[model samples]
Target: MCGITGFVDFTPASEEREVLIDTMTATMHRRGPDDQRTWLDRHVALGVRRLSVVDLVGGVQPMVAQRPGEPPVTLAYTGEVFNCDELRAELRSHGHTFTTSSDTEVVLASYLQWGAACAERLLGMFAFAVWDGRTDEVHLIRDRFGIYPMYYTEVPGGFVFGSALMALLKHPAVEPVVDTEGLRAIVDFVKAPENGIFAGVKEVRGGTIVRFGRNGLSVTTYWAPPARPHEDDLDTTVGTVRELLEDSVRRQLHSDVPLGVFLSGGLDSSALLALAARHNGGETLRTYSIDFAGHDKNFTPDEVRSTPDYPFVARMVEHLGTDHTRVVVSPEELMDPEVRREVLLARDIPTSLGDLDTSYLLLARRFRQDCTVALGGEGADELFGGYHWFLEDRFVDAQALPWLEFGRQMAGKNGLRNTGLINQDLVESLGSDEAERDLYATEVAKIERLPGESDVDRKIRTVTYLNLTGYLRIILDRKDRIGMAVSLEGRVPFLDHRLVEYVYNVPWAMKSFDGREKSLLRAAVRDLLPPSVLYRKKAGYPPIDDPGYDRALRAMVTELLADGSAPIQPFLDLGTAKSYLADPTSAASREKVNRFSLEMVLYLNEWLATYDARLAI
Candidate 1:
């Protein structure tokens, strides 16, 4: 809900400390534009940019607790801890006085009460840092799901930390190092590796609490979502799930500022809106939706692009009589060179994926005009077997990346270019960790027991774990970043840890049972949503259909190759680049397997150029 930054140098010069804090906080101005604060102790300095979601009038941060001469503990944070009220009551009973009704004080007080262990007890999507005025140490945390990103590095080529990698880059002392391992993971889109993009800037992995004490830095996993442990009956499971999801959505709706829902006409977001509308009763609930302009008729019978969503979205809004706003982005609009440039700046990285790039910024920009926070249907597919890849044959059978086979198919015919970013053959030859492989196999073994069966089911089940751990994480990460960059808070209700735990082992039969994908989910919320929406097939998020857009992207790629000034040229073959770019359908071609895009390549190149990245992995 805000931007947080700080340094744990025990003895830096006063001038440098002030400048560093100012610069770090400046990079996140978009995140917290309303207010910001900074303070210094003998050994530490803290800075924060405030968006003021929870405490609009008060709750200014970099809030300190110094006792006259004592070096005070200073705290700045980013995120919403949903359990603030309950914790506050307990803290008050223990005699802690609160100066404001903000969750910020709760975070600080919780830390004071339970110390570092406070992170485990609190439930929410967050990343925070606490400076121990007494010990000169810094404590940091990322939520259990990595919903909020935090990156850090040590001085020299290190010693910097930030909420966003770009913020970390603002530190004049920080250097961008190519994480060869991270790049390799991205090349194939290895979604689950807990690390980050920039090499030197290591991300505080999700579900972790890190400490920068005198013994140097250390990390411990405070929590891990209960992986599909054994479960109970469907009736009990669905009943408990409905209540947990309701509770999560209700708590996340906490904000002093205006809020709304990003309702897609599908199961997840639609269900969330339905629930919110039901809770609001006669009150008008503002809702927003995005749709493509000229794509082929999808789930709807009409040959209409953006057709299915309007009908279903209209139905949900009318049923609840909520104030709904629909934002349509034409393929041409997103493909505009200016939009691309603006998106890159907003992302603080050189990202090239068209669809993923579109939704977050567009949604955030438009939604922010009305509301600062919005609810989304992000984490549902991974949790409820919504992706076709989660279907039995798709997940458990002799899986050869069912979801990715399309990409691999593209590679065979499209003539993939060498990025030289990595030696793919060699990297794969090196193989995976025996320990890591064992963990993967262990989870897949459980999937092998699902009642419904198919040849590819076993492989698909293996992929289920991979999806939950890898692909889903990557996409969800993008979902968070794109929205946050625009200063609009995006919350995913389906990511409730309780729901994830129960559904994981509910037996694929229960999830995709009745031959319907996400059957269990549909059963749970069948009443809240209209039949059309409740039964509508998932089309993913809004998609694009502009031949012009692809043409524009291809032309840019070709032009970059023609200019020879692109930082990525050396990593790719001129011939391959020309073929891929000139063909026009390279990105759309399945044969273009493991291939890079102008977007991906541009982002990577810009990331390298922006950070002066040393690509020597």
Candidate 2:
């Protein structure tokens, strides 16, 4: 894992290029604390901050490959390619000699052997930029599922690209600006594909390749979930899922540094831990979970999260007999202004899930102390039907994104709306409602339907596609950014493209065969987990329910409203915010609605001030 940044400019000065690239690379110090390097030429500059996960001593960047009488091809890469060994063996047979055992070298070799088509052959989570001097072109590629992020924008002579938005923002050519479309994306939860949330900057969509050359920039999608007939019986399909999942987990276990699993005791994480334990040849595996300091006592059941993870976590720990540690975070830590600032910086935008983001950031920080790489269970919920919206009829039949509709319904129960606190005039001016409808239509149109498919089947597939492409992107981004922020690499075995493709085409009836959330997943791993965990209901990532955290948010919002120079004040409805703050309800009693509103106000203010973000609208 690493942080990569660079540019391809026709007009370049060597000294200035080095300084500029160095500055951009420095912003990602947290992503790669092990090593930093820069490579420069007249027309291109490449930089990387290395975490040294695989081939600790041998892997270094920006790595270059050259053949006599030919210009060198330099690669600044991030994320891991699990099929590196296989690709390396194949490349060797083609007379390619390698000096290092690094997957970075294997990626460069793949590019050399297949040119731009190399992205199609890769099987891992990655976003890499390859500068091919031979073709005088730079190719930016992201994994099929976009587990790794890549952002870029066109410059005067060429273009600049990076692993994170901050890297691109640090460049002199880019400005800290958020236009109307960007603002819409922030307020709306449906993340449009390739929307970078900054004017002129575009994210390299997953399963895509962006090539910049003399002719100009071009994008080609190398992969998407292809719709096909499902001919296998229920038993055969279950067996196939198990086989693909096991292969993915085994492939991701190849890491040089200490590795572990993020165990939430939920179906996703527990299943991964079970597989990891089985594959380790009886070697003890380290697992970790996160919880609030007083969660067990203060925890209140809601529609989303019904139970505390600790009980199930304990069961898994004892069942697997694996070494486990639970990181307990206090309300004070979650409410710390400095911690919030770091979370905002890590995300590069304000998120509505306040404590959810902070808790993950804190957990990643602690995880980094012991392990460089940790396997997670992220894509399982989206691939299998795990969310409440997937099971409930009202949500399933909703015309909009099922998750968005579910969010609205949940908030409505508290007499609140997702964006209720925002300025009404601003929302209309930004066309938030229209943008969401358009986005939904655009996404739904992208789903390839099977011939003779029933309306119910098509609707199910549409919802599944939306979740995989839209909601899953948010989950992956959060996991990647938070983990990378602490120099901890998070590997998601469930996100393997092979697994995603196979499961995506399975009929919904078979997916929910047992009439429960994640039925297919539970059936596949039934023997691996205790019934206590395998039968547990779907619970969202835990958030601190302590009133102290809510009190802190109220205090921060109060301070923001009082400050005459606060940037977010212009976009907020102060009267509504002040009324909410003045309400007599106890913080814990009114936690759901109040906490979300206050978090948005506080996070937006911090983001604007820290990033010097100007709202162009």
Candidate 3:
């Protein structure tokens, strides 16, 4: 919902330091175009770019609270604490009077009341910094789901933290250095916790607090998916899941600004729309969906995406009688250089899925024109065993992470991105396969299995954990980065900590009780949705099937071949790159490997030049 950047300097503060903080905040201008402000003290400097979602006129920051005798507590926060009204009431009862009707003040008072443990009592997707002038320390907290991103780097005097990696890179104290581990992380697609992809930088893990001050930094994990025994029957579990979901949707709908729901007509999105509509009562419900220009006419089934989204979206729109708008993107828009660059800027890294990432950015930007907040259906697949890999026998039995196994399957079919495209020497040096193996093992070891669990149950639980902890982060990060790029606040009720925890411990058997994906979710909201939508096979966000997009990508990558000094040349195998680009008119779904390879080459070259990145390896 907003962008936050700040620093704590153990050394003396100078005019240059203040300017650096300003520059850092400036990088996230698009994230918070509504307003900008800065706060400075002897050792701490905080900045915020606000989007003005709730209490728009009142919740301006960096908000500083000073009690009669206590040091001023300054807060630079990003995100809507969905439970603000309740928290404000409780804090008010405890003698905390609010001057502004804003959640930001409630958060500051919460810190004043509970100290570092304040993070434990909050609910919502947020990444914030609470500067306690009393203790001369700052507490950095990310939500339980890590929905909002917070990256930090330790500098000479103290540290620099920001909402995006680019925000941190804007400071002169940081450099674009990718070490071997960072490269491995980029290639492997396994989002290891706190793996920031740059040397000397780390992300604050979800449900954790990082305390930094003159004493140095300490991290404490306040929440995680607890491995608990299943204590309820199928019906009770279903009822409980439905109850939690309704509560989450009701809470998330507490937005003062105009809001909408993304309607893909998939189970997750439809259910969210249904629940949100119910919460809206008789009020008008605005909805939006995205699709390619000729998607329905040119639809092609694939392992990842089977059907087009437009038809299903139409059904939901008509069924719900909601005001709906469909944004149909053409191939040219998908291949536009400026648009692609903005997408790359949103995510300060070479994204793995090129069109998937850029399309959402474009759609979010369009949606921002009408509304500031949009509730989306993410985290459901991971939480409810909705991915196809969860049902595949090979992946279910594979000792590795199921998603990794799925990637291997894609590679075997010559469909995986970057397959047969990268330099073999780089692969050997990074040892990506081995690194991935180790990472999978580390993640698996973290899953605490229940006593007397069956082997089948154990394997399913492991896959569930991997998806929630690993794959879920990647999706959520994309959602946050792209959504914030346009100042669009994206809320995911499926990711509410309580819901995730409850479904996490439910046995996979019940999750797929009807021999279908997301059976539990389908059953929970069956009455609210049409059968066509309620039982529709899951489909991913559709990719542009137009061959023109592939041709455009090839033209861009071919230019790289002519320019031998291209930044990505050192990382590419010239022969393979040339071979892939020879016939570049096939759609990505038909020729995934070649299309993705060319897209990656262009993105990699641009990313290197954009950041002037250095490869230590």
Candidate 4:
């Protein structure tokens, strides 16, 4: 794994070039502490900070490939390509000679043969910028799932790209201002929309790439999840999903350093731990779990004594004899100003408020002590038939319908909020029906619109696929930032396209079985996990019980309200901000700091204040 940054401009000044690359690469010190490199030129400058994972002694960057007499292809990459062996074999047959067994080399070889299009063929979590000195062009690409994030900003004369927003911020040319529209996206509870945190900054949007050449810049899609037919039966689908997951796990297991998995006592992470246990062959696979010190009440629904996954975590750890570390963090720690600030700094952008984010911080902070690379069970629910609301709610009842009463309820519920920091933003996002409309349009564009098909089926396909595009992106990207912030490389076995493809084709009934969700998954490897853990109702990642996370968030908002330096203060009234946070449950209140809505305001406030951002275009 590594941190990459560079600039592609009409021309370059040596001082400006060095300063920009230095700023970008230094921001990711934790991500790649071992070594650093740079390739500077008149028009293109690339820098890399690397953590030696695969090529312990050999993997270095910016890596270049020249076949005896060809102009070089220089690459700075972040993330792992799980299918490097397969790519190597394919490239070998195509007359490529490798200098290293590293995936970076495989990528360079792919570029040698396929040129910029090599990105489309890669199967891994990655974001890379390949500078082809020969063509005097730069190609930037992100993985299909966006497992690795790539953020970039376009200035008057050039475009700057980096693995972290902080890197881009290091360059004086690139402003670190927060994007108000981005705040609106979050306040609308449409967090993680196409927009990123910084105003002028944006993301590559997974499954897409950008090619910067003399002809100027062009962006295009190189890959997307297939929305097509299933040629397999239930039994075959189950078996295939199982096999693919194992293969993905096997590939992720390739690391020069010792590796481990974060055991959250959830289906996703547990499944990985089970497979990893088998892979380790009785060797202690180091494991980490995040537990709240005082908020044990978070799991009260399952009966503290009876929660299947919790006991099962211990069981699995014992079964594998892992050097298990259960890190217990406090509600106080979760809200600690310094810890939170450290995390936000690493985020390169503000994260949504409350437990989901902080719980990850608890785990990732603990992970820093044990292993640099850890596997976690993520992406299964999206790829497979999971999520309580999706299974039991109107999403299915309305016949796979797009926004049923449930989605409308969500919009209405959020609409009812007082909207303190982002009342204006919330209203603006609601005004634009584009995001939801786009989902509907996407469904119609992809699915068959025959005369007789039930709207329910269409709705099911629509919400599931739309979520596959949207909600899934939010969570997976969240996992990426949270994990990487601690300089930890997290691998998701469930995101393996081979496995996701199998689950996508399997009927919901097979996966859920008798009105269940993820049943097919449970049945596939019943022997791997204990029956108690196998049948446990999905609780997902442990959440912080500080429901008042928003209250603390409000403190930040109040500070911003008094601090004129904040961009949105001019647009907001003090009464509106207080009302939104003080009494959100009431329709008459202003800020409406519920879990999701409050998060938006907190995100916006932190972003604006942190970066000294402005709102006006």
Candidate 5:
């Protein structure tokens, strides 16, 4: 894992380029604290901060490879290539020699052999920039599922790219500006594909390659979930899922540094822990879970999260007999201003998820104390129909994004408004409702329906596609930002493209054969896990429900409203904001609605001030 940034400009002097690249790279020091390196030429400069996961001693960047009489090719890479050994063996047979066992070297060698088509052959989470001195072109590639992040924008003479938005924002050519479209996406939480939420910057779409040369720029999607008929029976499909999942977990276990599993005791995570334990031979695998200081005793069941994770976590720990640690965090920690600032910086954008994002950041920080790489279960829910909304008929039939609709309904039931406290005039001008409808229609049109498919199957397929491409992307981005912020590499075995493709085509009926969430996943590992975990109902990551957290958020909102110079003040609906603040115990201040609204205001305030972001609305 690493943080990579660079620029291709014909104008900057080499010394000036180096200084700029260094500054951009330094912005991601938390991502790669192990080593930092820079490579420069007259027209381009590349920088990387390395975490040293695979080949600690030999994997260094920016790594350059050259053949006699051929232009040298340099790679500033991040994320691991799980199929490195296989690719290495194949490359070696083609007369490629290597001095190191690093996957970084394998990637460069593959690029040398296949040119731009090399991205299609890689099988891991990655976003990298390869400067082919041969053609003076740079190719930026992201994994099929976009488990890692890459952002870029065009410059005067050429372009600039980085592993994170913060890195790109540090470059002099980029500005912290959000246009109407960007603001709409942020406020409505309708993330358009490739929209970076910054005016000029664009996120490299997953499964695509962006090539920049003297001919300007081009993008080609090398991978997508292809529409295909499933011929396998229920038993065969179940067996295939198990095989693919096991292989993915095995490949990801090749890290050189200490690794662990994020165990939520839910089926998805418990399944991963079971597999990792089985593959550990005789060693005791390390597993970690996060909990609030008194959440277990004070736990309140909500519409989404029902049952605390600690009880299930304890069951898994004892069942697996692994070294498990439950990191308890206090509401004070969750409400800390400094911690909130760190979370905002890590995300490089404002979020309304509040403690959900902060808790993960804090967990990742603690995980980094003992592990460099940790396997997580992120894509399983999207792939296997695990969310509560997936089972509800109303959400399944909704024309809008199901999760967004669910959030709206949930908030409405609490006598509160979803997306509350934003300036009503700004929301109307952005046409957020129409924009969401258009976005939904655009995405739905892209789904390739099977010939003669049933109407029910078609609707389910569309919902699955939307969740995989939209909701899953947000989840993966959160996981990457928080984990990388602490220099901890998170590997999602469930997101292996091979697994995603296979399961994507599986009929929904078979996916929920047992009439349960993640039914397929549960059956695939039924024998590996205890029934207590394998049959457990779907539960989300626990939220901080302590009343103290709510008080802190209300206090912050009060302060923001009083401050005359607050940047977010212009965008706030003062009447609505003050109404919620007026009575903390009112229905308007219910934990779910109040936390979300307050979080948006607080996070947006911090982001606007810290990034000097000008709202061009």
Candidate 6:
């Protein structure tokens, strides 16, 4: 994994523009700490930071590919292309000879052989830019699932894009401004498609290509999971899922450096670890888990997380007999200002689950000490119906995105703290409710219902689509940003396009055939995992449950409130803010609702100050 950033210039390049590109690329140095390179042309300049996962010495970029008497194509790429060897062989047969063993070369060569359609032939989590000198155009492409992020902003001469928003913000022409809709997106959890949250900046939708030329830029969808009728029965679906998972794990294990698994002992991660171990045969695959200090003694069952992860993690670790390390974080570590600031900077957004994200960052940073890549279980929930919303009719049948429904329900229970505290008139003006409805409605409208499908099946398909495109993107982005922040490449075998496509068309009856969550998945991997893990109810990553952490948050928020000149104060209700700050660390104030409010205020303040954001709202 690496970072790619560049811009297509309608105007000629100069020394100043080169400096701007250098600054933009420097912001992503942590993403590609191994090597840094830039390629400049009269109308385009491309930059990349290399983590050196594949073709360590020869895979340098921005790589240029050409043939005799033909204009050259320069490629600035990130992420691994799992099938690059296959693509390379195919290109070789077509008289394209490679000078290097890097997939970066394959990407450039593939484009030379097949044009922009080459993106459809490649498979992996990638965000790349191809400058085709033949046509004097640049093509920006992201993986089908949007596992890699690509943010772009239209500027005076042309457009600028990068793997992260910070890179684009490094450009002098880009503004750190947010409008009403952007603010609503910040507070709300809706993963609006193509929404970048910054004024005039847009994220390239996954599975698509954006081409910039003399006629300006045009977007095209090169790939998407096809909607088709399911012909396979339950037994076949289970077998196929197992087969695809095995293949995905085997393919993803092609890292040159040491790799490990993020094991929580839940069905998803447990199954992935078992498969990875199976691929290794005799070798014990290293595994890692995250836990809170004193969690075993102070653990409390919650609606989302029933039991602590340590027990399940222990069982899996002991059963697998692999080299394992447990990262136990104390409340102090979770609430550390420096840790929180790193998390904020990594996400480049004010996420509601601040502590959990920070913990993941710590875990990732730790993993980097021993491994450059780690396989994580992320896309399984969206594809396998593992979330609570999948089992409940209310959320499944809700007209909005099911997770947003879950969020609202949690907000009602003080799960989303910032709900009523913010400016209601502003929230309403941003059409928070209507925005979610319209987005969900648009996604639902795009679902291609199968012939003779029942209402329940149709509903399941709609929810599945939203989960795959919306919820899964959130998880993927979180993992990418947090993991890449430490220069660790996080691979999701569960997100391999084949697995997602296969499971997406599976009938709802078959998915929940056993009247349990991820029934098909459980059946597929039950042979490898113990019954305890196989039957473990769905549990998300544990949050900071220590009251000491709450107290720390209160102190921080209180300090911010005391600073009347704080950037966020203008948007906050003083009385409400002070009231929450008064005793926000109490046990009664531990709900996600209160915590979200506290975290959001702090994040908003920091974000406004860090970016010097101009909020048009």
Which lDDT tens digits does candidate 5 get at residues 438-484? Answer: 99999999888799887777878888888887888889989988888
Candidate 6 accuracy as lDDT? 0.84
Off by over 4 Å in 4: 12-14, 177-180, 189-194, 297-309, 396-421, 424-435, 439-457, 546-568, 571-573, 576-591, 595-603
The alpha-carbon lDDT assigned to residue 165 of candidate 5 equals: 89
Clashing pairs in 6: 414-593, 415-592, 415-593, 416-593, 417-593
Going through the candidates in the order shown, the clash numbers are 35, 0, 0, 15, 0, 5
**1-617, model 1: which lDDT tens digit per residue?**
78888776644455677888888888888888888788876667788888888877768887776567877777888888888999999999988888898888898888888888998777787889998867767888887777877877766412567787777877776655655555555554432344666655567877788788666878887765444344577788777778888888887777788889987788888888877766654568889887666543423331112245677787888877778888877756776666566566565655546554865567678888999888888788877777655654433443443444433333321222223223344345323333334445554554434454444434434565567655666676677667766788878777766666666666665666668877888888888877888888776654454455556656666666666666765665455455555554554433342224455665666656655666655
* Cα lDDT computed for each candidate against the true fold: 0.68, 0.87, 0.84, 0.70, 0.87, 0.84
Candidate 1 residue 53 C-alpha distance from true site, Å: 0.7
Question: Residues 496-584, candidate 6, lDDT per residue (tens digit)?
Answer: 88888889888889999999899999999979999999999989988877878877877887788778788877777666565556655
TM-score per prediction, in order, is 0.87, 0.97, 0.96, 0.88, 0.97, 0.97
Kindly report which residue stretches of model 2 are placed more than 4 angstroms away from their true locations once superposed: 12-14, 412-418, 584-593
Higher-scoring candidate on lDDT, 2 or 6: 2
- Model 2, 264-301: lDDT tens digits are 98999999999888888788999899999988888888
Tens-digit per-residue lDDT, 199-249, candidate 3: 999999888899999899999988877888889999899899999999999
Q: What CA RMSD would candidate 2 show?
A: 2.0
- Write the number of the candidate with greater TM-score, choosing between 3 and 5: 5
Q: Give the TM-score of candidate 3.
A: 0.96
Error of 5 at 265 (Å): 1.1
**RMSD of each candidate relative to the true structure:** 4.5, 2.0, 2.1, 3.8, 1.7, 1.8
Model 3 spans with C-alpha error above 4 angstroms: 411-414, 583-592
Model 3: pairs clashing at backbone N, Cα or C within 3 Å: none
- lDDT by residue (9-74, candidate 4, tens digit) is 875465667776877788888778888888876687899988888978778899877657766778
Clash number for model 3?
0
